[model samples]
Target: MSVNNKTVWLTGASSGIGLALARQLANQGARLILTSRREQQLEELRQSLPNSEQHQVLALDLNQPEKAKETASAALKNTPVDILINNAGVSQRSPAMETDLTVYRTLMEVDYFSVVALNQVVLADMVKRRNGHIVTVSSVAGKVGTKLRSGYSGAKFAVIGYMDCLRAEMAEHNVRCTTVLPGFVHTQIAHNALTGDGSLRGKEDQDNASGISPEQCAADIIRAIESNKAEVISGKGMSKVAPLLQRFFPGLLRKMLANR
Candidate 1:
């Protein structure tokens, strides 16, 4: 299950964990198909990598879920995809009561439906080949709901459930599925997070600012993929403990989150 020489289609490649994962995967001799809304940034990233000529870029907005199938077809036209990384997602920092329904719909479209749409396209090919991997970047919020992240958490939770079912279904096809639950890596996610009115928060959260580096998170994710793991949780401190607390001590975890 080494990714060496494997062709990986990675989304959200312009920044944050996606960017770090691209660098690490490139170093492993994996040919990448990088996608994001920023074509210029994707080109810059490609030029910065070793063997830059070996990689490809396909810029598109995942917000438009209807286009994902077409995008996936174009991506696979050049190379048979050995792995598909569903990492493009949006975050939210608003209470459920105040947030507009459109905001929740937008988040679900980008974070959940888009992944499913893209996967539906690529997965058929993988089943035909009987060899491929689907890696999704979920969140700790998917495991434990928290304040100010209702929409974001709901979307992530859907991802977890979908991936779980996908893993079971793909098991017979020998196509691996790995769900990555990252706590909080130091990235632009918080700054780009949507507010109640669907406007960007434009301010980084203190917790995210003090979180683990994206490089470290990328390394952990790569390792998980290589190991053919079903799931991997990456983060530090309470982020690592929150899931456990929620599973074993729900009452205590609920009280703690309530007081936060």
Candidate 2:
């Protein structure tokens, strides 16, 4: 599970935890194929990495789930992907009752279906090679329900469930699956979060502003990958406690979340 010299295909590599992971993985000598919606930003990130020429950039819009298979195929054509990181996702900051149906659809498309689509595209190759790793970035919301995040929580929950099943299935194949449930990390996710009407929230949440750094999250994620952990929850303080509480005391956790 050593990342050194492994070919890692990472989505959402333009910013946030993805960017931090790209930098860290590059430093660890992992060849990278970076993807996101912003080609310019990906190119800039490539130039900033330790071995700029060793990495490749393929700008992708995960929102377009139909193109995921083709996109993944192209990436595979260039180089066999030893690791596939599904990190491209969006967040929501609206009450479920008031949120538009389109919002839910969009969230599911980008956060859940797209991951499945791309994973399917590369899975056969991984099975054939008998060596591959699949890592997904989920959210604490996936572990527990919270107010103002109905769609976001649902999509992330699906990701966790999907990865869990994939892990069990891939075990005999020697392929590993790691699901990362990150609490409120300091990222632009809040600013870009969808509102009730499907418009961007454009405001940073107080908790997110004070959450763990993306670099720390990325480092923890790399450790989880190397260890081949089934799941890892990364965050600080209460963010770390929330999942434990949810697993041990559901009624109490529900009440606590209701007050949030």
Candidate 3:
């Protein structure tokens, strides 16, 4: 689908990939509804994009998915969202044994449930119109498991399953569901990752430090959406090849992960 003139509702738009995507979509002539908990940052980002005044800002916490679902769905009921990008999420940096149950719950709520909720809000409209795209930002972790990401990977993996099913269902409706599995992008995700105790890690991972730029990731994602690709992977490190390896060399991949 052409991004030009499309009304894209983007979450997590205050920073990182979402921020970069907002800029690119605006430059491509799309109107946007930028969402994030940081109202000030969202407004600032909206203004910096092209056709700034034409965009909308609706700051809401995805952590509170119920409220977000209600508010966002309400906003779109009359707005006709041509695209919905489920990019709002949190991350984790702890193993299953060490991570608190609450931490896992938080990850599931923010990373999995919230994406479903927001997508549900937009699905009806898209199905009715029979012309819309839903791009969800999962992670390369979704395709493979590793250390320090049990909860995060679990949620991401769930997203893959959910979006895969959605893609199949939406195909007949002429609605596209493209799941993007990005690896470690150079974003604050690592620094903001939840630890074992459900507290922020507040430190950057070496993987993220060396990962692809958010702008680059966003561009790739935009291309995937435009092409209606079912799935696309981005970023650096083993993320690029882990899925292939897992499929062809499961035991080797497991052994390699164990050593990491």
Candidate 4:
């Protein structure tokens, strides 16, 4: 789908990939509705965008399942979303056996359920109008199991499954769904990820600090949307090899990851 002048809603727009995409789409002439938990950052992002009134900032907590439809409705008050970028997500890093149930709940709410809820809200309208694109920002973890990323992988895998099903359901309706699996992007996700204590991790992971930039990730996402791709994977090393390794040598991959 062409992004020119399209109305798009991007969640988690305060920073990282969402912020990068907001800037790119805004420059491409798309009307944007940006949402995140940080109003101040969202305001700052709004200032950097091209369109003033055409773009809006709504601070929202994706942890609240009921808030998904409400937030979408609020955004619709400003303009219809021709594209929904379900980018807001939380990550968790701990031994799955040691991970707290609370962290699991929070991860599921923010990373999986919230996206599903918001999609349901906008789907009816899109189906009726027969023109819409849903771009879900998942991760390479969605396709391969990795150590210290059980919850994160679970949520992203759920997104891939749901979007795959949604694609089949919407095939005859003229709606498009694209799931993007980025390997690792230079974003605040690692710092923002929930720790064992239900607090954000204070330190950045080695991989996150040395990963691809969000601008590069966003460019790939935009290209995938333009092509209406069902799925697109980004990054070099682990990004390219993980899927192949998972498919052909699952036991070896598991052992390799454990050693890492």
Per-candidate clash tally: 0, 0, 0, 0
Instruction: For each candidate in the order shown, give its overall lDDT on alpha carbons.
Output: 0.93, 0.91, 0.90, 0.87
Clashes of 2: 0
Q: What is the lDDT of residue 10 in candidate 1?
A: 93
Candidate 2, lDDT over the whole model: 0.91
lDDT digits (tens) for residues 1-260 of candidate 1: 99899999999999999999999999999999999899999999999998999999888888888886787676576467899999988999998899999999999999999999888868887999999999999999999999999999999999999999999999999999999999978999999999999999999999999999999999999999999999999999999889999999999999999999
Q: Sort all candidates by lDDT, best to worst.
A: 1, 2, 3, 4
Residue 117 CA error for candidate 2 (Å)?
0.9
**lDDT tens string, model 4, 5-85?**
898889988888998999999999998888888889888889878877778877888999687578667657536679999
Better model by lDDT: candidate 2 vs candidate 3: 2
Candidate 4 structure, TM-score to reference: 0.96
Give TM-scores for every candidate, taking all chains together and pairing residue i with residue i: 0.98, 0.98, 0.98, 0.96
Residue 239 displacement in candidate 1 (angstroms) = 0.6
Candidate 1 to native Cα RMSD, angstroms: 0.9
> Cα deviation in Å at residue 77, candidate 3?
2.1
Which residue pairs clash in candidate 3? none
When 1 and 3 are scored with lDDT, the better candidate is 1
Alpha-carbon deviation at 136 in model 4, angstroms: 0.5
